[model samples]
Target: MGAADSVTACLSKGVGALVGTIIAGSKSFIAKAKILRKTLGSGMRQVGVLCAPALFTLEENKAKILAEGLNKIKGLKVDTASVQTNIVYSDILKSSNITETHLCNILEAHRVLTMPKGPFKLRLVIHHQISESDVKYTLSCIQKAVNGFIG
Candidate 1:
């Protein structure tokens, strides 16, 4: 989209390709990536078997990224079963040693925006604009913030 030389992104994001990524850019960039993939022993054939379920799930539009986020951090209590929509509400446990404002600030530093629902509650609203990779990044940042605050 930009005038950049190359672009690489996780396939498991938005598209739900699961196991691989789509690389697009200059011819030389693609060629070099193929060479690197082969060298790393990542070049594969018939990967469709692993991708079928991902495709079906994407078609059904049933995958929610918040569930993955809810599973990554220990200090946050989120009911995965209750997360049937785009909004995720997390309860910041006292054991985390961090308040809602602290967590929000930490995530904001990483460019991941979040809302403090109350003194100890966090509210995250996911829209179609937010990709799976974005969710993953947010979870990682939250985990780091919690760990940093505790240790």
Candidate 2:
């Protein structure tokens, strides 16, 4: 991954500096990468400045705000253990009668944006800007969306 893609938990496009390090000890790999990079185009500028916010966001949201916030929602099913960092994979209960696309459409209609991963799954990206109240509002909106689709 490029510098920006690794940082910001991949949220801000390619803005921040690189995230992790590669421990490869081969000059062959390095030389090949150097040649390949030309085809990948040039790097970013001022992305170093973006790294500060990206680091802060990753540190802040990853610890407490990710799955803990999402799992509290009422009709949504979240595998709490599967939540590793700032991403939450949401599943709708079969009994809820709401498809992922329908839920996402309803949520978007209510001004709450969501990304659908599959017919039954949604991918939620949590960031530092999302407060506890924001999570509550999201849940509330999801509830409303589900209600709209149910009837």
Candidate 3:
């Protein structure tokens, strides 16, 4: 419900993840904040440094990156128009003969990390830290992985 919605919304990078809404003067909000602060008590120091890069990343054209860049990668089934933000749901077709886990393992072996959503779906998060070259490299890696699995 906070910043990591995966929806188009400001394209908040993982560094800018917000777990709760900040509504000033709201008693409920204050109570929730207190509970989280006491219960969670988890945090990182010098967050401002991370936010600096996050702010820069949020400025790029996420829509274009997903639609034109990611979708263009062959073998990854993605409906680009539906991609309004930084999150992309990529599918490894069943016919591809590679499970999402295997694909993820292959990608990880090549230093590319991705999350497997299901038997064949992957939840891909692209931040500004990922460049066009990175995208190309990722696609190529996946393609190679699929090929290797098939062979």
The clash count of every prediction, one per candidate, is 0, 1, 0
TM-score of 1: 0.55
- Quote model 2's TM-score: 0.58
Q: Which residue pairs clash in candidate 1?
A: none
Candidate 3: RMSD over Cα atoms? 7.0
Residues 58-149 of candidate 1 have per-residue lDDT tens digits of: 55432356665666678888877766445678898998789999888888888878899987998886654566777777777888889894
Query: Which regions of candidate 1 deviate over 4 angstroms?
Result: 1-63, 149-151
**Where is model 2 poorest over a 10-residue stretch in terms of lDDT?**
14-23
The candidate that wins on lDDT is: 1
Candidate 1 vs candidate 2, lDDT winner: 1
Query: What is the C-alpha local distance difference test score of each model?
Result: 0.72, 0.63, 0.64
User: What's model 3's TM-score?
Assistant: 0.58
Tell me the lDDT of model 2 at 131: 72
